[model samples]
Target: MSGTDEASAREALRSGDLTIIGRIRSASNATFLCEATCSDEVVHCVYKPVAGEQPLWDFPDGTLAGRELGAYLVSTALGWNIVPYTIIRDGPAGPGMLQRWVDQPGDSDEVEPEGPDLVDICPPESVPPGYLSVLRAYDHVGNDVILVHADDRRLYRMAVFDVIVNNADRKGGHILTGVDNRVYGVDHGVSLHVQDKLRTVLWGWAGKPIDDETLESVAVLGEQLAGPLADQLREHITADEIEALRWRVGALLREPVMPGPDRHRPIPWPAF
Candidate 1:
Protein backbone atom coordinates (compact mmCIF):
# COMPACT_ATOMS: atom_id res chain seq x y z
CA MET A 1 0.00 0.00 0.00
CA SER A 2 1.08 3.62 -0.68
CA GLY A 3 0.25 7.14 0.46
CA THR A 4 -2.33 7.49 -2.30
CA ASP A 5 -4.24 4.51 -0.96
CA GLU A 6 -3.96 5.87 2.62
CA ALA A 7 -5.13 9.33 1.55
CA SER A 8 -8.21 7.94 -0.15
CA ALA A 9 -9.00 5.79 2.86
CA ARG A 10 -8.46 8.72 5.21
CA GLU A 11 -10.90 10.78 3.13
CA ALA A 12 -13.53 8.09 3.54
CA LEU A 13 -12.87 7.85 7.28
CA ARG A 14 -13.15 11.63 7.78
CA SER A 15 -16.27 11.80 5.65
CA GLY A 16 -17.76 9.70 8.44
CA ASP A 17 -16.42 12.23 11.01
CA LEU A 18 -13.53 10.12 12.23
CA THR A 19 -11.21 13.19 12.66
CA ILE A 20 -8.18 11.66 10.95
CA ILE A 21 -6.22 14.19 8.87
CA GLY A 22 -2.83 14.97 7.37
CA ARG A 23 -0.76 12.50 5.30
CA ILE A 24 -1.54 8.84 5.95
CA ARG A 25 0.99 6.04 5.85
CA SER A 26 0.39 2.29 5.50
CA ALA A 27 2.47 0.68 8.24
CA SER A 28 1.44 -2.94 7.69
CA ASN A 29 -1.38 -5.13 6.43
CA ALA A 30 -4.23 -2.75 5.51
CA THR A 31 -3.66 -0.38 8.49
CA PHE A 32 -2.69 3.30 8.32
CA LEU A 33 -1.79 5.78 11.08
CA CYS A 34 -2.45 9.46 10.33
CA GLU A 35 -2.27 12.68 12.31
CA ALA A 36 -5.45 13.65 14.13
CA THR A 37 -7.23 16.65 12.64
CA CYS A 38 -8.24 17.87 16.09
CA SER A 39 -5.84 19.43 18.58
CA ASP A 40 -5.20 17.80 22.00
CA GLU A 41 -5.57 14.41 20.34
CA VAL A 42 -2.75 12.25 21.61
CA VAL A 43 -3.65 9.35 19.31
CA HIS A 44 -3.33 8.91 15.57
CA CYS A 45 -6.31 7.59 13.64
CA VAL A 46 -5.83 3.90 12.75
CA TYR A 47 -7.55 2.19 9.84
CA LYS A 48 -7.50 -1.41 8.61
CA PRO A 49 -8.98 -3.10 5.52
CA VAL A 50 -11.68 -5.73 6.02
CA ALA A 51 -9.78 -8.34 4.02
CA GLY A 52 -6.07 -9.23 3.97
CA GLU A 53 -3.45 -11.99 4.22
CA GLN A 54 -3.94 -14.89 6.61
CA PRO A 55 -1.80 -14.79 9.77
CA LEU A 56 0.80 -17.39 10.75
CA TRP A 57 -1.51 -19.26 13.11
CA ASP A 58 -4.49 -21.28 11.85
CA PHE A 59 -7.86 -20.25 13.23
CA PRO A 60 -11.01 -22.39 13.54
CA ASP A 61 -11.19 -23.18 9.80
CA GLY A 62 -8.28 -21.24 8.30
CA THR A 63 -10.70 -18.48 7.27
CA LEU A 64 -9.30 -14.99 6.85
CA ALA A 65 -12.53 -13.22 7.82
CA GLY A 66 -12.96 -15.27 10.98
CA ARG A 67 -9.34 -14.78 12.01
CA GLU A 68 -9.48 -10.98 11.63
CA LEU A 69 -12.67 -10.77 13.68
CA GLY A 70 -11.16 -13.05 16.31
CA ALA A 71 -8.03 -10.90 16.63
CA TYR A 72 -10.05 -7.71 17.16
CA LEU A 73 -12.36 -9.29 19.71
CA VAL A 74 -9.69 -10.90 21.91
CA SER A 75 -7.38 -7.91 21.90
CA THR A 76 -10.15 -5.55 22.92
CA ALA A 77 -11.32 -7.93 25.64
CA LEU A 78 -7.83 -8.36 27.08
CA GLY A 79 -7.30 -4.58 26.93
CA TRP A 80 -4.20 -5.11 24.83
CA ASN A 81 -4.05 -2.87 21.77
CA ILE A 82 -3.35 -5.49 19.08
CA VAL A 83 -5.38 -5.18 15.88
CA PRO A 84 -5.94 -1.65 14.56
CA TYR A 85 -9.46 -0.11 14.27
CA THR A 86 -11.72 -1.37 11.46
CA ILE A 87 -14.11 0.22 8.96
CA ILE A 88 -16.47 -2.16 7.19
CA ARG A 89 -17.12 -1.05 3.61
CA ASP A 90 -15.92 -1.13 0.01
CA GLY A 91 -12.58 0.64 -0.45
CA PRO A 92 -9.75 0.96 -2.97
CA ALA A 93 -8.57 -2.41 -1.66
CA GLY A 94 -12.06 -3.90 -1.46
CA PRO A 95 -13.96 -4.56 1.82
CA GLY A 96 -11.68 -4.42 4.94
CA MET A 97 -10.91 -3.10 8.44
CA LEU A 98 -9.57 0.47 9.07
CA GLN A 99 -8.17 1.18 12.51
CA ARG A 100 -6.26 3.98 14.29
CA TRP A 101 -2.57 3.64 13.49
CA VAL A 102 -0.10 3.00 16.32
CA ASP A 103 2.14 6.04 16.80
CA GLN A 104 5.72 4.92 16.25
CA PRO A 105 8.70 7.08 17.32
CA GLY A 106 10.66 7.69 14.17
CA ASP A 107 11.16 10.40 11.58
CA SER A 108 7.46 10.92 10.75
CA ASP A 109 8.02 12.26 7.21
CA GLU A 110 10.75 9.79 6.31
CA VAL A 111 10.42 6.21 5.08
CA GLU A 112 9.80 3.86 8.01
CA PRO A 113 11.52 0.53 8.65
CA GLU A 114 10.07 -2.26 6.49
CA GLY A 115 12.17 -5.08 7.84
CA PRO A 116 11.48 -7.29 10.89
CA ASP A 117 10.84 -5.04 13.93
CA LEU A 118 13.89 -4.31 16.06
CA VAL A 119 13.05 -5.75 19.52
CA ASP A 120 16.04 -4.42 21.45
CA ILE A 121 19.23 -2.53 20.92
CA CYS A 122 21.75 -4.90 19.34
CA PRO A 123 23.10 -7.40 21.90
CA PRO A 124 20.54 -8.00 24.69
CA GLU A 125 23.25 -7.83 27.34
CA SER A 126 24.18 -4.35 26.19
CA VAL A 127 20.68 -2.80 26.48
CA PRO A 128 20.63 0.42 28.52
CA PRO A 129 19.02 0.18 31.98
CA GLY A 130 16.44 2.95 31.45
CA TYR A 131 14.84 1.01 28.56
CA LEU A 132 14.16 -1.89 30.93
CA SER A 133 12.22 0.47 33.19
CA VAL A 134 10.25 1.59 30.11
CA LEU A 135 9.22 -2.01 29.43
CA ARG A 136 8.00 -2.49 33.01
CA ALA A 137 5.91 0.69 32.89
CA TYR A 138 4.24 -0.22 29.57
CA ASP A 139 2.15 -3.01 31.08
CA HIS A 140 0.94 -0.97 34.02
CA VAL A 141 -2.35 0.94 34.32
CA GLY A 142 -1.18 4.54 34.30
CA ASN A 143 -0.01 6.47 31.22
CA ASP A 144 1.82 8.96 33.47
CA VAL A 145 5.42 7.75 33.48
CA ILE A 146 6.30 9.54 36.72
CA LEU A 147 3.28 8.06 38.48
CA VAL A 148 4.26 4.60 37.31
CA HIS A 149 7.12 2.89 39.09
CA ALA A 150 8.95 -0.04 37.49
CA ASP A 151 8.87 -2.70 40.16
CA ASP A 152 8.80 -6.51 40.33
CA ARG A 153 5.01 -6.86 40.70
CA ARG A 154 4.02 -5.41 37.30
CA LEU A 155 6.68 -7.41 35.44
CA TYR A 156 5.40 -10.66 36.93
CA ARG A 157 1.82 -9.79 35.95
CA MET A 158 2.78 -9.05 32.33
CA ALA A 159 4.80 -12.24 32.24
CA VAL A 160 1.80 -14.24 33.44
CA PHE A 161 -0.32 -12.61 30.77
CA ASP A 162 2.28 -13.51 28.16
CA VAL A 163 2.47 -17.06 29.46
CA ILE A 164 -1.30 -17.60 29.39
CA VAL A 165 -1.60 -16.02 25.95
CA ASN A 166 1.33 -18.04 24.59
CA ASN A 167 2.85 -14.82 23.28
CA ALA A 168 5.51 -15.82 20.73
CA ASP A 169 7.11 -12.42 20.16
CA ARG A 170 7.72 -10.40 23.33
CA LYS A 171 11.01 -9.15 21.90
CA GLY A 172 12.30 -5.98 23.63
CA GLY A 173 11.65 -3.93 20.52
CA HIS A 174 7.96 -4.92 20.46
CA ILE A 175 7.57 -2.79 23.56
CA LEU A 176 7.27 0.92 22.69
CA THR A 177 8.53 3.91 24.68
CA GLY A 178 6.06 6.75 24.13
CA VAL A 179 6.69 10.50 24.50
CA ASP A 180 6.03 10.15 28.25
CA ASN A 181 8.65 7.39 28.32
CA ARG A 182 5.84 5.12 29.45
CA VAL A 183 6.10 1.80 27.60
CA TYR A 184 3.38 0.28 25.43
CA GLY A 185 3.57 -3.28 24.07
CA VAL A 186 2.44 -4.06 20.51
CA ASP A 187 2.50 -6.83 17.86
CA HIS A 188 0.69 -9.68 19.58
CA GLY A 189 -0.27 -11.48 16.38
CA VAL A 190 0.90 -14.78 17.84
CA SER A 191 -0.81 -15.24 21.20
CA LEU A 192 -3.40 -17.56 22.78
CA HIS A 193 -1.34 -20.53 21.62
CA VAL A 194 -2.44 -24.17 21.61
CA GLN A 195 1.22 -25.17 21.41
CA ASP A 196 4.20 -24.44 23.64
CA LYS A 197 5.43 -21.18 22.06
CA LEU A 198 6.26 -18.92 25.04
CA ARG A 199 9.43 -17.01 24.05
CA THR A 200 10.39 -13.92 26.06
CA VAL A 201 13.26 -12.36 28.00
CA LEU A 202 10.91 -11.87 30.97
CA TRP A 203 11.77 -15.36 32.15
CA GLY A 204 14.70 -13.88 34.05
CA TRP A 205 12.17 -12.87 36.70
CA ALA A 206 10.77 -16.40 36.80
CA GLY A 207 12.16 -17.48 40.17
CA LYS A 208 11.71 -14.05 41.69
CA PRO A 209 8.07 -14.97 42.55
CA ILE A 210 4.83 -13.06 42.09
CA ASP A 211 3.89 -10.01 44.15
CA ASP A 212 0.56 -8.83 45.63
CA GLU A 213 -0.12 -6.18 43.02
CA THR A 214 0.17 -8.73 40.21
CA LEU A 215 -2.02 -11.19 42.08
CA GLU A 216 -4.68 -8.53 42.49
CA SER A 217 -4.49 -7.64 38.82
CA VAL A 218 -4.91 -11.29 37.87
CA ALA A 219 -7.96 -11.53 40.11
CA VAL A 220 -9.46 -8.46 38.48
CA LEU A 221 -8.87 -9.92 35.03
CA GLY A 222 -10.37 -13.21 36.12
CA GLU A 223 -13.53 -11.51 37.36
CA GLN A 224 -13.81 -9.49 34.15
CA LEU A 225 -13.22 -12.63 32.14
CA ALA A 226 -16.57 -14.18 33.16
CA GLY A 227 -18.60 -11.01 32.63
CA PRO A 228 -18.23 -8.31 29.95
CA LEU A 229 -15.08 -9.84 28.52
CA ALA A 230 -16.82 -13.17 28.09
CA ASP A 231 -19.79 -11.47 26.44
CA GLN A 232 -17.46 -9.65 24.06
CA LEU A 233 -15.53 -12.76 23.08
CA ARG A 234 -18.71 -14.78 22.57
CA GLU A 235 -19.58 -12.75 19.50
CA HIS A 236 -16.55 -13.70 17.34
CA ILE A 237 -15.07 -16.60 19.28
CA THR A 238 -16.30 -19.86 20.79
CA ALA A 239 -17.68 -20.29 24.32
CA ASP A 240 -14.96 -22.86 24.89
CA GLU A 241 -12.52 -20.21 23.73
CA ILE A 242 -13.56 -17.75 26.41
CA GLU A 243 -13.46 -20.53 28.99
CA ALA A 244 -9.91 -21.37 27.90
CA LEU A 245 -8.79 -17.78 28.41
CA ARG A 246 -10.30 -17.77 31.87
CA TRP A 247 -8.67 -21.08 32.67
CA ARG A 248 -5.27 -19.87 31.53
CA VAL A 249 -5.49 -16.71 33.62
CA GLY A 250 -6.64 -18.66 36.66
CA ALA A 251 -3.93 -21.27 36.23
CA LEU A 252 -1.20 -18.66 36.06
CA LEU A 253 -2.53 -16.85 39.12
CA ARG A 254 -2.53 -20.10 41.01
CA GLU A 255 0.84 -21.36 39.81
CA PRO A 256 3.82 -19.54 38.36
CA VAL A 257 5.29 -21.91 35.74
CA MET A 258 4.89 -25.34 34.23
CA PRO A 259 7.56 -27.96 33.65
CA GLY A 260 9.38 -27.35 30.37
CA PRO A 261 11.56 -29.29 27.96
CA ASP A 262 15.23 -29.02 28.93
CA ARG A 263 16.08 -27.72 25.43
CA HIS A 264 13.83 -24.68 26.10
CA ARG A 265 16.76 -22.97 27.89
CA PRO A 266 18.43 -22.10 24.59
CA ILE A 267 16.83 -18.93 23.13
CA PRO A 268 15.63 -19.02 19.53
CA TRP A 269 18.50 -18.49 17.06
CA PRO A 270 18.96 -15.07 15.40
CA ALA A 271 16.79 -13.75 18.23
CA PHE A 272 14.51 -11.10 16.77
Candidate 2:
Protein backbone atom coordinates (compact mmCIF):
# COMPACT_ATOMS: atom_id res chain seq x y z
CA MET A 1 0.00 0.00 0.00
CA SER A 2 1.10 3.60 -0.70
CA GLY A 3 1.72 6.11 2.08
CA THR A 4 -1.69 7.85 1.70
CA ASP A 5 -3.58 4.59 1.41
CA GLU A 6 -1.85 3.26 4.53
CA ALA A 7 -2.78 6.36 6.49
CA SER A 8 -6.40 6.16 5.34
CA ALA A 9 -6.64 2.49 6.18
CA ARG A 10 -5.42 3.11 9.71
CA GLU A 11 -7.94 5.92 10.14
CA ALA A 12 -10.82 3.75 8.90
CA LEU A 13 -9.90 0.92 11.24
CA ARG A 14 -9.31 3.15 14.25
CA SER A 15 -12.56 5.17 14.33
CA GLY A 16 -14.61 4.48 11.21
CA ASP A 17 -18.20 3.31 11.19
CA LEU A 18 -18.35 -0.36 10.37
CA THR A 19 -21.25 -1.88 8.45
CA ILE A 20 -21.54 -5.63 8.23
CA ILE A 21 -21.57 -6.67 4.60
CA GLY A 22 -21.75 -10.45 5.07
CA ARG A 23 -20.29 -13.39 6.96
CA ILE A 24 -17.10 -15.02 5.72
CA ARG A 25 -18.60 -18.53 5.79
CA SER A 26 -15.30 -20.37 5.56
CA ALA A 27 -13.82 -18.82 8.68
CA SER A 28 -13.58 -20.94 11.82
CA ASN A 29 -14.64 -17.94 13.88
CA ALA A 30 -17.59 -15.62 13.23
CA THR A 31 -15.68 -13.41 10.80
CA PHE A 32 -17.56 -10.86 8.74
CA LEU A 33 -16.73 -8.88 5.63
CA CYS A 34 -17.32 -5.25 6.57
CA GLU A 35 -17.32 -1.84 4.94
CA ALA A 36 -15.51 0.71 7.12
CA THR A 37 -16.27 4.37 6.44
CA CYS A 38 -14.64 7.39 8.02
CA SER A 39 -15.37 10.83 6.58
CA ASP A 40 -14.75 10.27 2.88
CA GLU A 41 -12.34 7.33 3.30
CA VAL A 42 -13.76 3.82 2.98
CA VAL A 43 -12.33 0.32 2.78
CA HIS A 44 -13.51 -3.28 3.01
CA CYS A 45 -12.23 -5.12 6.08
CA VAL A 46 -12.52 -8.27 8.15
CA TYR A 47 -14.13 -8.00 11.58
CA LYS A 48 -14.10 -10.74 14.20
CA PRO A 49 -16.32 -9.81 17.13
CA VAL A 50 -15.52 -11.09 20.60
CA ALA A 51 -19.08 -12.29 21.06
CA GLY A 52 -18.73 -14.44 17.95
CA GLU A 53 -15.47 -16.14 18.94
CA GLN A 54 -15.56 -19.81 19.81
CA PRO A 55 -14.24 -20.86 23.19
CA LEU A 56 -10.96 -22.69 22.87
CA TRP A 57 -9.49 -25.12 25.40
CA ASP A 58 -6.28 -23.10 25.74
CA PHE A 59 -7.17 -19.45 25.19
CA PRO A 60 -9.56 -17.57 27.45
CA ASP A 61 -12.96 -16.64 26.07
CA GLY A 62 -13.50 -13.15 24.55
CA THR A 63 -9.77 -12.49 24.53
CA LEU A 64 -9.13 -13.47 20.90
CA ALA A 65 -9.81 -9.98 19.58
CA GLY A 66 -7.22 -8.45 21.87
CA ARG A 67 -4.71 -11.10 20.90
CA GLU A 68 -5.26 -10.26 17.26
CA LEU A 69 -4.53 -6.60 17.97
CA GLY A 70 -1.53 -7.52 20.06
CA ALA A 71 -0.12 -9.55 17.20
CA TYR A 72 -0.56 -6.60 14.85
CA LEU A 73 1.29 -4.31 17.24
CA VAL A 74 4.21 -6.71 17.50
CA SER A 75 4.32 -7.06 13.72
CA THR A 76 4.49 -3.27 13.40
CA ALA A 77 7.21 -3.03 16.02
CA LEU A 78 9.27 -5.57 14.10
CA GLY A 79 8.88 -3.43 10.96
CA TRP A 80 7.97 -6.52 8.93
CA ASN A 81 4.43 -5.32 8.25
CA ILE A 82 3.40 -8.95 8.09
CA VAL A 83 -0.09 -8.33 9.42
CA PRO A 84 -2.49 -5.82 7.87
CA TYR A 85 -3.54 -2.62 9.60
CA THR A 86 -5.70 -3.70 12.56
CA ILE A 87 -7.40 -2.31 15.63
CA ILE A 88 -9.72 -3.13 18.52
CA ARG A 89 -12.87 -1.04 18.46
CA ASP A 90 -16.66 -1.14 18.73
CA GLY A 91 -18.35 -2.54 15.64
CA PRO A 92 -21.94 -3.33 14.66
CA ALA A 93 -21.54 -6.73 16.37
CA GLY A 94 -20.08 -5.05 19.45
CA PRO A 95 -16.31 -4.92 20.18
CA GLY A 96 -13.88 -6.78 17.90
CA MET A 97 -10.64 -6.84 15.93
CA LEU A 98 -10.93 -5.03 12.60
CA GLN A 99 -8.32 -5.37 9.86
CA ARG A 100 -8.11 -3.87 6.36
CA TRP A 101 -8.83 -6.53 3.76
CA VAL A 102 -6.13 -7.27 1.16
CA ASP A 103 -7.13 -7.98 -2.43
CA GLN A 104 -5.55 -11.19 -3.86
CA PRO A 105 -5.61 -12.24 -7.46
CA GLY A 106 -8.30 -14.54 -8.88
CA ASP A 107 -6.89 -18.04 -9.49
CA SER A 108 -7.70 -21.71 -9.98
CA ASP A 109 -7.64 -24.49 -7.38
CA GLU A 110 -5.61 -26.79 -9.62
CA VAL A 111 -2.30 -27.86 -8.05
CA GLU A 112 -0.18 -25.77 -10.44
CA PRO A 113 -2.53 -22.79 -10.85
CA GLU A 114 -1.26 -19.17 -11.07
CA GLY A 115 -1.29 -15.86 -9.18
CA PRO A 116 0.05 -14.88 -5.72
CA ASP A 117 -0.86 -17.98 -3.72
CA LEU A 118 2.64 -19.00 -2.65
CA VAL A 119 1.65 -22.19 -0.85
CA ASP A 120 -0.06 -25.16 -2.55
CA ILE A 121 -0.34 -28.93 -2.70
CA CYS A 122 0.50 -31.00 -5.74
CA PRO A 123 1.66 -34.45 -6.74
CA PRO A 124 5.21 -35.15 -5.50
CA GLU A 125 6.67 -35.21 -9.01
CA SER A 126 4.76 -32.08 -10.05
CA VAL A 127 6.01 -29.85 -7.24
CA PRO A 128 7.21 -26.48 -8.60
CA PRO A 129 11.01 -26.31 -8.89
CA GLY A 130 11.20 -22.93 -7.18
CA TYR A 131 9.06 -24.07 -4.22
CA LEU A 132 10.24 -25.90 -1.13
CA SER A 133 8.45 -29.12 -0.31
CA VAL A 134 7.14 -29.04 3.28
CA LEU A 135 5.35 -32.37 3.68
CA ARG A 136 4.19 -35.44 1.81
CA ALA A 137 0.64 -36.67 2.41
CA TYR A 138 -2.38 -38.16 0.68
CA ASP A 139 -5.81 -36.97 -0.45
CA HIS A 140 -9.12 -38.55 0.58
CA VAL A 141 -8.67 -41.05 -2.21
CA GLY A 142 -5.09 -41.85 -1.08
CA ASN A 143 -3.30 -40.17 -3.98
CA ASP A 144 0.04 -38.62 -3.05
CA VAL A 145 0.08 -34.88 -2.45
CA ILE A 146 2.95 -32.70 -1.28
CA LEU A 147 2.51 -29.42 0.57
CA VAL A 148 4.96 -26.79 -0.74
CA HIS A 149 5.64 -23.09 -0.37
CA ALA A 150 7.62 -20.74 -2.59
CA ASP A 151 11.22 -19.74 -1.89
CA ASP A 152 10.28 -16.08 -1.59
CA ARG A 153 11.84 -13.53 0.76
CA ARG A 154 8.63 -11.88 1.97
CA LEU A 155 7.12 -15.19 2.97
CA TYR A 156 10.36 -16.10 4.70
CA ARG A 157 10.19 -13.01 6.88
CA MET A 158 6.62 -13.89 7.82
CA ALA A 159 7.85 -17.27 9.01
CA VAL A 160 10.37 -15.50 11.25
CA PHE A 161 7.63 -13.19 12.58
CA ASP A 162 5.43 -16.20 13.34
CA VAL A 163 8.13 -17.55 15.65
CA ILE A 164 8.22 -14.30 17.64
CA VAL A 165 4.43 -14.32 18.14
CA ASN A 166 4.17 -18.06 18.70
CA ASN A 167 1.34 -18.15 16.17
CA ALA A 168 -0.73 -21.30 16.75
CA ASP A 169 -2.42 -21.44 13.36
CA ARG A 170 -0.65 -20.35 10.18
CA LYS A 171 -2.48 -22.32 7.54
CA GLY A 172 -1.73 -22.03 3.82
CA GLY A 173 -4.84 -19.94 3.16
CA HIS A 174 -3.76 -17.43 5.83
CA ILE A 175 -0.79 -16.39 3.63
CA LEU A 176 -2.02 -13.90 1.05
CA THR A 177 -0.45 -11.73 -1.64
CA GLY A 178 -1.80 -8.24 -1.18
CA VAL A 179 -2.90 -5.92 -3.98
CA ASP A 180 0.47 -4.22 -3.45
CA ASN A 181 1.98 -7.65 -4.19
CA ARG A 182 3.37 -7.99 -0.66
CA VAL A 183 2.96 -11.24 1.25
CA TYR A 184 0.70 -10.98 4.33
CA GLY A 185 -0.52 -13.28 7.07
CA VAL A 186 -3.94 -13.19 8.82
CA ASP A 187 -6.08 -14.94 11.47
CA HIS A 188 -3.84 -14.37 14.48
CA GLY A 189 -6.44 -14.79 17.26
CA VAL A 190 -4.61 -17.88 18.52
CA SER A 191 -1.21 -16.25 18.72
CA LEU A 192 1.08 -14.95 21.51
CA HIS A 193 0.49 -17.64 24.08
CA VAL A 194 2.81 -18.00 27.07
CA GLN A 195 3.45 -21.59 26.17
CA ASP A 196 5.01 -22.62 22.87
CA LYS A 197 2.25 -23.61 20.48
CA LEU A 198 3.79 -22.50 17.18
CA ARG A 199 1.99 -24.48 14.50
CA THR A 200 2.36 -23.23 10.92
CA VAL A 201 2.83 -24.38 7.31
CA LEU A 202 5.76 -22.07 6.45
CA TRP A 203 8.50 -24.47 7.54
CA GLY A 204 10.29 -24.28 4.19
CA TRP A 205 13.06 -22.24 5.82
CA ALA A 206 13.54 -24.65 8.67
CA GLY A 207 17.13 -24.61 10.03
CA LYS A 208 18.18 -21.80 7.67
CA PRO A 209 20.40 -19.01 9.02
CA ILE A 210 18.70 -15.66 9.60
CA ASP A 211 19.78 -12.78 7.37
CA ASP A 212 21.38 -9.70 8.96
CA GLU A 213 18.39 -7.47 8.14
CA THR A 214 15.88 -9.76 9.86
CA LEU A 215 18.16 -10.12 12.88
CA GLU A 216 18.26 -6.35 13.13
CA SER A 217 14.46 -6.21 13.07
CA VAL A 218 14.31 -8.78 15.87
CA ALA A 219 16.80 -6.79 17.90
CA VAL A 220 14.76 -3.63 17.42
CA LEU A 221 11.66 -5.48 18.61
CA GLY A 222 13.47 -6.55 21.80
CA GLU A 223 14.41 -2.96 22.61
CA GLN A 224 10.87 -1.75 21.91
CA LEU A 225 9.45 -4.31 24.32
CA ALA A 226 11.47 -2.62 27.05
CA GLY A 227 10.00 0.72 26.02
CA PRO A 228 6.40 1.20 24.80
CA LEU A 229 5.67 -2.22 23.24
CA ALA A 230 5.53 -3.87 26.64
CA ASP A 231 2.95 -1.39 27.87
CA GLN A 232 0.92 -1.84 24.67
CA LEU A 233 1.01 -5.63 24.93
CA ARG A 234 0.06 -5.66 28.61
CA GLU A 235 -3.39 -4.41 27.60
CA HIS A 236 -4.08 -7.53 25.52
CA ILE A 237 -2.01 -10.47 26.83
CA THR A 238 -1.01 -11.50 30.30
CA ALA A 239 2.24 -10.14 31.77
CA ASP A 240 3.62 -13.66 31.53
CA GLU A 241 2.83 -13.83 27.81
CA ILE A 242 4.70 -10.60 27.16
CA GLU A 243 7.67 -11.91 29.09
CA ALA A 244 7.57 -15.05 26.96
CA LEU A 245 7.71 -12.85 23.88
CA ARG A 246 10.83 -11.17 25.21
CA TRP A 247 12.44 -14.52 25.81
CA ARG A 248 11.54 -15.71 22.31
CA VAL A 249 13.18 -12.65 20.77
CA GLY A 250 16.29 -12.94 22.88
CA ALA A 251 16.58 -16.65 22.08
CA LEU A 252 16.21 -15.97 18.36
CA LEU A 253 18.96 -13.36 18.43
CA ARG A 254 21.20 -15.79 20.22
CA GLU A 255 20.61 -18.51 17.65
CA PRO A 256 20.20 -16.25 14.60
CA VAL A 257 18.35 -18.63 12.33
CA MET A 258 15.03 -20.22 11.44
CA PRO A 259 13.89 -22.95 13.83
CA GLY A 260 13.30 -26.58 13.06
CA PRO A 261 9.76 -27.85 13.49
CA ASP A 262 8.51 -29.91 16.40
CA ARG A 263 8.04 -33.51 15.37
CA HIS A 264 4.79 -33.43 17.29
CA ARG A 265 2.04 -31.21 15.83
CA PRO A 266 4.21 -28.96 13.67
CA ILE A 267 1.41 -27.96 11.27
CA PRO A 268 -2.20 -26.93 11.77
CA TRP A 269 -4.93 -29.29 10.69
CA PRO A 270 -6.79 -28.61 7.43
CA ALA A 271 -3.44 -27.10 6.28
CA PHE A 272 -5.20 -24.66 3.93
Best-performing candidate as measured by TM-score: 2
Q: Which candidate is the best by lDDT?
A: 2
lDDT of 2 by residue, 64-107 (tens): 99999999999999988899888888989888899888876543
Q: Kindly list the per-residue Cα lDDT of model 1 for residues 1-272, writing each as its tens digit.
A: 47765566545454443433432332334454444342223335544444543455444432333334444554444554344444344334454444445456564667464532323422333343333322222214543331111333334445566665666566654545443323455545445545566666555454455556656666776787867766755664566655666777787678745323233532332233
- lDDT: worst 10-residue window of model 1: 144-153
- Whole-model lDDT per candidate: 0.48, 0.90
Off by over 4 Å in 1: 1-31, 34-43, 55-57, 60-99, 102-157, 257-270
Question: Which 10 consecutive positions of candidate 2 have the poorest summed lDDT?
Answer: 107-116
Clashing pairs in 2: none
Q: Cα lDDT for residue 141, model 1?
A: 54
lDDT of candidate 2 at residue 40, scale 0 to 100 = 93
lDDT of 2 at 53: 98
Model 2's alpha-carbon lDDT is: 0.90
